[model samples]
Target: MKWEHALKDYKLYLKIERGLSNNSITSYGLDVEKLIGYLEDKHISVSPLNISKETIQQYIYELAKTVNVRTQSRMISGLRSFFNYLIFEDYRVDNPLELIESPKIGRKLPDTLSLDDINRLIAAIDLSKAEGERNRAMLETLYSCGLRVSELTNLKISDLFFDEGFIKVTGKGDKQRFVPIVQSTQKYITCYKNEVRNHLSIQKGHEDTLFLNRRGKQLTRAMIFTIIKQLAVKINLDKTISPHTFRHSFATHLLENGADLRTIQLMLGHESITTTEIYVHVDKSHLKSVLQTFHPRK
Candidate 1:
């Protein structure tokens, strides 16, 4: 089969079978596309079904020179998953990446913001501007609910369950979870909706969307990143941060405050408890306190 045809089928399997998000599918597709590009550049005619391990190794060798170890490792993983899909479909006998070893990279802990830092960042928003209240609400929701940026953007007006003190969030792979919402956050969101969002001439499909741009369209992921970056600059924050920083902070802060891993895992909508364990590493002091309080030796 042609590379393009194989790629199209692979993407369909990712969406329908694996239930990956669009961004995830696109990322996986890009890995295969990069291999295709490499073959074309070298004038090597090889289809996905018949591509040899040597060709893939050569591609990896070339790729390692351009990307960092982490990126190279991720690309290899993506390609491996694609080939595994082919095997699952009975299109291939074995994956070309079966013997390929990924680089050994240390687990990089996520960066977290201190409560004071978070407060300063939020305080820096220009409240006089029309988007100020919206920005405040967005940041509060991000931290309070431990939401992914995409979840925040795709949040709908109907998702708010203030009477029950939870907001329904659609996480990765479209998995839905109800996260508890603090009354303060609820108030901010309500104020923004009643004041600013109500005033917006919302576009046709975006009326249900929680956050909208000045044009009344759904806010893009890039826009959320831009908003956080701008706020960091306004506060003169030294560390580089993104919207995910708030999530990391949310998890870390909860762990520090004696919240259990299982509880935090549920709140963050993590599919694996292992994913939530990273926060334990984020706050060693919390662990020390726990040991001091509970250990018989203490």
Candidate 2:
């Protein structure tokens, strides 16, 4: 089959069978597209069904020279999944990337903000502007609920269950979960809703969306990043951070405050307890306190 045809089918498999998000399917598709580009550049005519391992290895060798190990590793994984899909469809006998090994990179721990740092960042918001209250509410919900940026952007007014103190979040793969919301966060969100959002000439589709831009539509993910980055600059903070940083801080702070892994896992909507265990490594002081409090020698 042609490379384009194979890629289209692969993306469909990712969406329908694997239930990956659109962003995830796009990323996976790009991996195959990169290979197609490489073959075209070299004048090598090989289809996805018949591409040899040597060709893929050569592509990786060239790729390693241009990208870091982590990026290279991710691309390799994406390509591997594509080939595996071909095998599942009975189009291929084996994956070209089967024997390829990813580089041995150490686990990169997530960066977290201290409570004081968080406070300073929030305090730096220009409350005179209408968006200031919205920004404050967004950040509070991010930390309080440990939501992914997409979840925050896609959040709807109907998702807020303030009477039960929880907000329904739609996470990766369109999975939904109920995460508890603190009263303070609820109050901030309510204020933004009753004041700023209520005044917006909201677009028809985004009327249920919790956060709206000045254009009265759902806020984009980039806008959220820009808001946090601008706040970091206003505070003169040194760390490079993104919206995900607030999520890391949320998990780390909970662990430090004696919340167990299982509970944090549920709150974060992690499919695996192993994914939540990373926070255990984030706070060494918490580990030390655990040992000191429970160890027989102590």
Candidate 3:
């Protein structure tokens, strides 16, 4: 089959069967497109069904030269999954990447902000601008609940349950979870909603959206990143930060302040404790504090 046709089918399977997010499907599709480009570059006429393992390995070898070891590992994994999909569909006898080994890469720790850093960022918002309150609310929600950028942008007014002190979060793959919302976060969101969002001429489809741009539509992930970057610049902070940094800070701070990993995992909507365990490597002092406070021998 043609590379284009195979990729289309694979994307469909990922969305429908695997329930991957659009961003994830696009990422996996990009890996397949890269292989197709390599084939075209060399004037190789092999189709996805007929591609050899050696040719796949050659593509991977070339990819390694362009990307870092961690990115190369991820590329290898995405390509492998695409071929495995072909096998699952009975279109191929075996995956071309079956024998290909990914590069060994160490786990990189996530960057997090200290409480003082967060305060400085929040304080730097220019309250004179109409978007200032909205930005403050957005950042507070992100840090308070450890929300993914998409989750923060897609947050709906209907999701807020202040009476119960929880906000319903729709996470990756549309998985829903109830995360407890502190009164402070609730106050900020409510202030923005009442004082700012309520004054906007909201677009029809975005009526339920909690955060909107000046155009009255939902915010984009890139816009959220831009807002944070501008704030970092305003404060002259010296660390590369993103919307995810607030999330990492949320988890790390929770772990540091005596919250257990399982609780953080649930609050962060992590499907497994293993994914949440990365915070343990962020600060050894937290571990020492836990041992001292809880261990009977102490």
lDDT by candidate, in order shown: 0.94, 0.94, 0.94
lDDT of 2 by residue, 1-298 (tens): 9999999989999999999998899999998899899999999998999999999999999999999999999999999999999999999999999999988787889999999999999999988999999999999999999999999999999999999989999988999999999999999999999999999999888989999999899999999999999999999999999999999999999999999999999989899999998888889999899999999999
Quick one: how many clashes does candidate 2 have?
0
Candidate 1 lDDT at 209 equals 97
Per-residue lDDT for 125-188 in model 3, tens only?
Answer: 9889889999999999999999999999999999999999999999988899999999999999
Per-residue lDDT of candidate 1, residues 1-298 (tens digit): 9999999999999999989899889999999899999999999998889999999999999999999999999999999999998999999999999999999898889999999999999999998988999999999999999999999999999999999999999999999999999999999999999999999999999989999999999999999999999989988899999999999999999888889999999999999999999888889999899999999999
| Model 1 spans with C-alpha error above 4 angstroms | none
Residue 88 lDDT in candidate 3: 94
Estimate the overall C-alpha local distance difference test score of candidate 1. 0.94
Clashes of each: 0, 0, 0
What does the lDDT read for residue 76 in candidate 2? 97
State the displacement of the C-alpha of residue 177, model 3, in Å, after optimal TM-score superposition. 0.4
Which one wins by TM-score: 1 or 2?
A: 1
- Lowest lDDT 10-mer window, candidate 1? 275-284
